[model samples]
Target: MLIPFLIMLREGIEAALIVGIIASYLVQSGRRHLIPAIWIGVLLAAALSLFAGAALQWLSAEFPQKQQEFFEGVVGLVAVAMLTSMVFWMKKSARTLKRRLQDSVEHAVHDHPGSGQGWALIGMVFLAVAREGLESIFFLLAIFQQSRDWAAPLGALAGILVSILIGYGLYSGGVRLDLRRFFRLTGMFILLVAAGLLAGVLRKFHEAGVWNHLQQVVFDLNDTLPMDSPLGTVLSGLFGYQAAPVLGEVIAYVLFLTISLACFLRASTPDTSAGAPTGTAMPAVTSPAASSPASNA
Candidate 1:
């Protein structure tokens, strides 16, 4: 339950932040007429995400047991990849995102130069929101398959609702937040979740009989603390806790978390030695007001 809630919360906040940035830009630039188009794009993206998730669930239900395991394994692998890439991408882009988005909007307006402007902005917001929405759906699907608890979906719904409220607050209520620190902490938590998913993918692959060479049990903690217990279930759902993990699963989990964290930390560190080029002023889009407080909402 907690797992899905956090996942959905992060994803929802990301989508909301994108929309907020675009909307704020439009208002500041006197292009408020295109606001409706932005909302339309958001609605369409949300609808498409819901449709895609339902379709995948329906399709998975039709598969046989063996095929289902294989499908789950594939989906888990995909989710890990997507989650990892998202974390790293957010870390790298957080600082420059405001400027880049503003520039893109400006380019779109200039390129279209007429009635087509609305369509261009609509397409931009649609693609941006849809990307995050689809990513969230995939992660949720993978999580639901593993947890198989009613609470998971409920948690996800709650997270999304909260994120929407927060987004609204950031946009209209002028809420102040330290977005840089928020992304950093969430990114770290997501990396741990992705590592667990990677281990689960390995387990699913073994269950599907695709890999049987390293099936030896690494350790057994089930005797001391059964995974089906109330607390154990929460841990398993939130962090992919395994009581009797196979050797390969343990290795994969450790290696993924260790290496990924190292790379993430290194990438997030600033290069202080490099000085800015002379005769170049920071763009207005990079200004504090222009960037808006909702960039990370």
Candidate 2:
């Protein structure tokens, strides 16, 4: 639930920021007429995400037990990779994201010069939102399958609600943000989630009979870490806790965390090389949409 909450929050903000950039740029350019198209794109994306999630859930219910576990494991692993990469990608390129989105929009609009809700603009917005929305479906579905708890979706809903408020505030110049700090903190928590998911993947492989590396129990602590206990539940919910993990599971988990965290830290630190920005993804300098004409410095 924690992992899903954070993933949704970050993804929600990214999509919102991109859409806000487009809408703000349109208004600033006196192309407010295109605002309708923007909202249309957002609505369509929402519909697609909802439809996909519902349909997938329905399909999963029809699967046999083992098949269901296999499918869930694969999807969960994919979600972990996607969400992890997304965080770091945003960390590395968020500063450029606005410019890229802006450039794409500008190019599309330019190609269709003197446009009134031009097909190009409509398609651009649709593609942007739909892409993120579909990604969200995968993350949500993966988490839902793993926890099998209703709270997972509810937690995601709450996270998104909070993120939307924060995103809107940033867009409207109602508040200043420390996005660098934000990403750093959440990124750390997510790293733990990835470690847990890695263990989960191994469990699935064992269940599928693909890996028989460690059939013996490493140790059993279920007596103390009973799933019914609050702390144990939290650990289980976020880290795929196993009362008795095999040697293979332990090795995979430790190696994954060590390598993943090292990579993340290496990425987060300042790079003195050419054109590497000092901050995480941030608002543009001197853009009409920015709160001030000056840069953050």
Candidate 3:
């Protein structure tokens, strides 16, 4: 439950930020008329994500045991890939995101005047929302499959509601968020979650009879900390804990965490090149739609 809540919160904030930034930019440049298009795009994206998730879940429910395992494995694989990419991409681009967005707005409004402008912005907003929405669906689906508890979905719903409040506060100039610290912390947690998903994917593949090597049990902790226990269930839901993990699962989990963490840390390090510091915490941004011209700065 906690895991799903946190993941959804992070993902929700991300989607809200993208839409907020774009909407802010449009208003700033005297293109307030296009604002409705942004909301339209958001609604369309939400509908699409809901449909896709429902379809996948329905299809998987009808599959045989082995086929179901294979489907789960494939979904987990995609979720891992998307989560990894999102972490790295945000780390790389968070600083420039606002500026690039503003630039894109300029191009969209100026390069193609009239109806084309609205379409361009709609497309931009649609893609942005859809990317985050789809990512959340896959990640949540993986969690839901494992935990199979009512709390998981409820937690996710709570997270989304809270994120919407936060997003609205930010937009209304009522909230100040240290986005840099937020992303950094969440990114680390997400990496751990992705590692667990990857391990789970491997197990699913084995269950589906796609791979059989390295199946020896590495350790057993059932007597001490069984996965079905209260604490064990929390850990399992959060980090994919196992009472008796296979050798392959252990190896894959360790290797993924090692390499991924190394890269993430290195990327986050303050660059000392040219005697100039880099990777400073981004200052809390004022409402981008605030009347004050310097609000965004």
Number of the top candidate by TM-score?
Answer: 3
lDDT of 2 by residue, 84-149 (tens): 776677777766777888788778887787654467777888888887787778778877777676
Q: Is candidate 2 or candidate 3 better by TM-score?
A: 3
- Listed per candidate, the RMSD to the true structure in angstroms reads 3.7, 2.6, 2.2
lDDT of 2: 0.76
**Poorly placed runs, candidate 2 (over 4 Å):** 114-117, 275-281, 284-297
Task: Write the residue-wise lDDT of candidate 1 on 1-297 in tens digits.
Answer: 777778788888778777777777888888888889899889989999999999989988999997899888988898999899889887777656768888989998999978888889889988998988888888898998986769989999998998887677666635555566677788889999999999999888888889786779988999886899988887787789998989899999999999999999887676555563322221212222545333333
Ranking, TM-score, top scorer first:
3, 1, 2
Residue 60 alpha-carbon offset, candidate 2, angstroms: 1.4
Q: What TM-scores do the predictions have?
A: 0.91, 0.89, 0.94
For candidate 1, the 10 contiguous residues with the lowest summed lDDT are 279-288
Model 3 C-alpha RMSD to native? 2.2
lDDT of 3 by residue, 94-145 (tens): 7677778778888888888889888888888889899999998998888888
